[model samples]
Target: MKTLINITLLSFAMLFMSMLNAQDTVKKKNGEVLKVVVKEINDSQIKYYHFDDPNQVLFTLDRMTITEIKFAYGKEYKEEESIMTDDYFTEDQNMVLSLSMSSMLFDAIIISFDKAIDPKSGFQITGKLLGIGFGPSFENWYNRSGFDLEVGYKLKFSGLKKKKWEYRPNHLLSGRYIMPSVGFTTYSEDRSSSQIKKNLIHLGLKFGNLKIIQKLIIVDYYTGFAYFGGSKKRTLNSYGSDVDFEYNDINAGDLLGSGNFAVTFGFKVGLAFGQYGEQKEKLKRRK
Candidate 1:
């Protein structure tokens, strides 16, 4: 009777041990399954220990290699973020404030402010402070400032997957886009005794890109051609009198291409400040 009791007790203990050994299964991309007890999951990998092992030694599996994890309770852990989704072309509605590096270096001091009217359209206005003539034009000149404004409609050509189109947001005004703009500029170059003035209208068509980092920092680069119209002249002569006309074999138009046509290239670096300004706030919260 005592031997029978011992056998029955031993059978119950073995059954309990088998139940305790059962755990979740990790499914790998290669179709292998690991019976594991997951400890933690993070952006990079999954940490777990073998369910049936006596020592229960911890192990790590690459998040990319994992297809999914299935638990005994029917819960699952799957990687949801894709590599393609992290690209700069992700759709966003952030206002961009940019400064032209080329204009700052060689031609003018240009500050541009832009805001999206929608996902596909935006407007930009630029304030420019012109530089003084360095060569034979004047002894001293000051105060050359004006504004240029334009509206753009964007067209994107990359990453068009018909299956994912409805799920993925459309980005017309971000990343690789075609940009067309029209603008007007007026500035006066004041010399010691006289002033030269300009009133110009511009039309441009360019390819452009706006890359966002951390969803707050922006880098803008574009290159295209601009057609300029209107005119420029010395309104007040060196003699301090309103001049009727000054004739030269080579006018300002001839030197600057009829004040009409030229190439346009810009590189801008700046910050996005509107709805996307929460990037900094989000980062702080994470810390």
Candidate 2:
């Protein structure tokens, strides 16, 4: 009787151990099976690992392309803030925020056109005009997106064996000073419509051609010039309206009216993001 009772207890223990091991093992539909050690399960994804690869793999909630991933952990977002304290934003979010702080919302009517004449000398012809200027504000000036056109050219004396396009690295220099003509003001008379000046500087790199046929290993980086200055603008007349151009003198910043011109100086840098077109693929083949 004692022996039988011991045997029954041993069997029960073995069964319980087997069940526990099974819980730890997860089988996928594919025959390429991977044992899983379940960690913490969340509403979004599952945390586990294969027997061979001990790395903690996180599966997405929707089962996206990635087969495994680590747990989605870290940070939160608030209503008023633009950048959040999340791992995903650690890379480029801060730079974008910094740009927002420096830029002021303003009314700007600018037209710029650039033409590329030589692919070897790394030269480009450019022309720009700004009329009916305004203020520079970023807080509520989202309606201000500018229009610019740029063309690049390169000239190589003996590159690509006399091929139409020669591939090499090049640079271009640019500079400007811009005065914002628009911002939050008490009255219309406090600011003028056109007496605004802006400053800008650009040191361009990677001015060579990236044509497919003449493709060489390509890598380049250009830094924006360190810029500093405040923005201000005042319009004397409403152009056609009966609005007066004089400040009430209560909240005006120093200058008021058209006759009273203020020297508002600002500096701007240029970093060309990309200058490619839809027909870019085809153009790469020849030059």
- On TM-score, the candidate that comes out on top is 1
Q: What is candidate 2's lDDT per residue for 1-287, written digit by digit as tens?
A: 99999999999999887655443433332323345555654533446654345355554221211133322232221112112112211121110000111122233332212222222233333222121244543213222222222222434332212111211122211111111122222222222343222222222222222211112222221122111222234333445433233431211211112222322212222223222232233466878
User: What is the per-residue lDDT of model 1 for residues 1-287, given as tens digits with 9 covering 90 to 100?
Assistant: 99999999999999888779769999876778988988888876789998877787899986767678988667877755445332323345458788776554443656778775444446676665555323333313255544445555555454323222133433433566677777666666666556766677777787878777776778888777777766667755545545344521111211123335666777788877665335435656999
- Model 2 residue 254 CA deviation (Å) reads 26
For each candidate in turn, the TM-score is 0.51, 0.23
Give the C-alpha miss distance for residue 239 in model 1, angstroms. Answer: 8.7
lDDT of each: 0.61, 0.28
